[model samples]
Target chain A: MIFRSLLAALALMFVMSTATADQRWQRVEAVTQALDNRVPELEGLSLELPLVAEDGSSVSLSVSFTGSLEDGEHIEKIRLFAPGNPRPEVADITLGPLASPANIATRIRLSETQQVVALAITNQDRAFLTTRDVRVTVSGCLVGGGDASAMAMANPRLALAGSARPGQPVTVRSLINHPMETGLRPDGQADDSIEQQLVESLTATLNDEPVLTARFFTGTSANPYLQFQLTPEEEGELKLAWQDQKGEQMEASQAIKF
Target chain B: MGNLFSDHLSAVLWAGALLGVVYGMIAQWSRFCLLRGLFNRWQQNDSRRLRAFALAMAVALVSSQWLAWQAGINLTRTPYHPGNLPVVALIVGGLLFGYGMALANACGARSLVLLGTGNLRSLLVLLVLGIAAYMTMSGVLAEFRLWMEDLYRPTLPATDLTLVTAPLGLDTETGRLVLAGLLSLALTAWALSSRAFRTSPRDWLGGLLIGLLVAAGWWITGVLGADDFDPVRLASLTFVAPVGDSLQYLMLSTGTSLRFGVTVVAGIVAGSFLVALLTREFVWQSFTSPGHNGRAIVGGFLMGVGGIMSIGCTLGQGLSGFSTLAISSFLALAGIVAGSRLALRFSVGSSASH
Candidate 1:
């Protein structure tokens, strides 16, 4: 009887492995279809993810490129897809002309260990892809609690790394402690569909000249955070303003001296 | 310019290494050992080392609070301040660790320092300890550890000192401040109470320096290392997991990047080696007998398992976790002391053995 059970267990393991492989291929196919069936060049695109993540609520992810784009050609859109998340489509970013170099960093919620894919589209109609395997052991917000809108703009936190100087590059990181409800998920408390509320826009200006601006979607992770670089022409007040989908606008500024 | 995570990650690793080197040097120069403090106090009626440990804790508490106030760090979110308490695991692990340290003659951090000073016995202790810690952390013993966590885990209304006082109508920050202040004051008084301890400048300096370094660690991981997109985990001086991480990093360096904990492990050894060389304390030493090697091996293995189960070692729990005022830290500390006293009673027949 024990020998038979062992044989059964081995068969079960083989079946499970094959099932997982099929799912992975399906996710890749889905991403390829989203990119208009074009097989994206794997070069020049790099996806950065921690090998192991304890908290699935807010895992940091970055998509960067070195030599993917031709001269005068820039990346127009970047989409982050996590096969193991509640929603496969994590975030779709539309970059305007003034968007800081093709590198972008943001946080996303992962449900479990799975393959994460980043696909980028250039203005020249070219598609590129990069993929990473992330292992998430803990679930961050499987059950959504608390009201995301109650304390919408109470505390807006910011971390500035690298010295801020004229002609010197500085990285600005900002996180507004807000539960970005996607309207699709239910708030476990009352079984009510949480309204789709998210930070719709972020704009940064140096001495009143626009340096960076971004638009986010419902798929953007909670406590929306963004990190970008700026090399100032002259030291002045760096203003960061965020306007949520609710049309609630919050602003913070820091004086940068040259 | 490059991947911001990698950029800041390497920055955090380099910073961790520098801080670690400093720690190793100071630890060797001052002869700082947490287990020794307790053993000496009980066995020889000497309280100098104990006073140093107390002074370090007191200083760390005040400075960490100050950093939180300045940097706007919420200590509540740190790993040490988790909402649930694993009662059985902590008590059992802490007891095993205390008894192990007694047999081994040093804690994990001390073993690293001793290893740098050319003590081959410490090398063996650290290897066994690291492997055992990894076993309990993610290896064969992980399932057992998970079962213990699942069985004994109890969610508290709050995990820190604020839980008891929060219901009494005090706000969290206020409650935390009052509690931390009282504890720091009491510790400082005790450290200064003994005339012999008071006159020992080395003890006072060691305590003060180690305390400030612990606070500095919080700032590194919490403030400078804090990035909204990819912030490093908020942690301070801890020896158990880091030793295991150091070993793992050696094997999986390509697949995994260095973290604050792993760098600190490397730093402590590097720093200790440099100091030992400068002070002419770098003598090659090994186990005196087969029996001695067996004792060290057993003690190190127990410490590794205990450290993982409790989630911190003497430095990790006794200082870093204690600084946060986590209730689990206190429970683990009590368990450690009880275990140490038990070992003194049974193993050596008296407290005066070493």
Candidate 2:
């Protein structure tokens, strides 16, 4: 009987150890898979993000693309993916001819330390890729309870300015108010989590032609602020529309004289 | 439709000029000094100077809170709050800065005034402080700050200490305002009741004016400076980054945009010069020894690094942060006082030594 009991104990220990090691390996594999999946076009796109963000919510991100775009051939879209997030898509923008070749700035939310991927697609349908490892130090998004959602919502504001000269840089600024909720937050209880509902996309147009676009994630501020430059051929009306996960949308239009 | 006055660029510039004049006038009147307040309390039995500072803090807290509540302004959006606690950095940085302020015999804002009055020592300190601050903010010291953050990490959900109290079922905003106001009033009353304090209208006026300047700073950046495409950094008059910013502006005026703090720093110097010259206070001054100059330089560097690390100087954290009623600012202010006390205890000519 004693010999039988010792054999069983040894077997249990071995099984448990193997299971733990397997779990660790799985996590490592997930990280590796995230890194391996990165598209290469990101090499030409300079990404400026904090190495370690003090607040995971509304972390500032600035991206500048260096490669030349021929006439009628522009970056059709740029998509950002955060692998660790429940909903990995952070932001996606479809850039038109009028948009600047090099710059886009916005804020986004991160659920945790994970790989952030940026995929830039040109009008020719060629895709460029970049991936970065971002560590979320501490999250500052969800501080209070039911009131947080209310407090986070803000009235969207828009501003536009540029010189009347053709191909001159026209600056556009847009502000939106929303919590950009990440589904990962605990809902008062340990087991319950808040469902993510946030602004998913934003698009800007100069004279009805797309000039800039953005995809947003929970990392965006309660009132998301974005600043971008466009080189419009001629001055006309600038239209901006934002869409969120709840199917809520807001639009603002401004007439540009220059 | 947009002339120079109506144009956004000109409006901002004019606003900046106006702000500069106001700050200069107030600073000239108040003789505000974080070092003086804390140092006097430590070195002498006098707490009146300290009380005056508390009065400023109380006024700042009540007024700022009132403005936010009334105008629907979110004070937390500013750098003072950042909606995070930053406990370790605040306390540690504050203590180090407080010591340096004492040794230098003034804080950043005070040093600025002293510099205007032909205080050669202050000039040396200001240069060192500015360079050191830049080092900590973006240069060599940044690496160390990052490493330390990773090492002695706290279990804060977010670094904003207000979050701690918010969860405890207290009226977060109201509680803060009331607490600050009561403290300020109590301190002010105590100071004013004393005959010595009552007689010094010049000092009292200086404190009041400086207090107003703190409020003006918030309005400029938070309200008028708000632009969608080229948003000004949400800030007030804090010496650490501002000093570095001033230096950068001098070097790269065309490249970089002018900010409120930088403009304010410039304005203060110019304003002070005008005031001093008009008042027959301007005089050239210089130090005798290279060693003395070196000490001034080192002291300035310490003030810069310490201020950045703490996130404000005596004026920056003491007045601006305190006005916001940020918990981190309070912790930093305490640290400044403690550090100053320690320096006083050790220094040969320290008032306490006498």
Off by over 4 Å in 1: A1-60, A64-77, A82-89, A94-103, A107-115, A121-128, A132-154, A157-174, A178-224, A227-258, B1-15, B167-169, B226-231, B346-352
TM-score, candidate 1, first chain: 0.73
lDDT of 2 by residue, B1-354 (tens): 125466454455556656666666566556666667666666677766776776666666666666667666666666666333556676778877877776666778777776776777787788778878878765677555444433443444433445555676656665666566676777677767777767777666666666666776667665665655444556666787887877766775653456567777777777777777888887887776775565566667778878877779887888778777666687888888888777777751453231
lDDT by residue for model 1 (A7-31), tens = 9999999999987753463455558
lDDT of 2 by residue, A50-136 (tens): 666534666677777777666777776666666665555566676777876646777777756666666677767655656566666
Query: Number of clashes in every candidate structure?
Result: 0, 21
- For model 1, the local distance difference test gives 0.78
Reference-based TM-score of each model: 0.72, 0.67
DockQ of each: 0.16, 0.08
Best by lDDT: 1
At residue A13, candidate 1 shows an lDDT of 99
Residue-level error in angstroms, candidate 2, position A21: 47
Interface RMSD of the predictions, in order shown? 5.9, 9.1
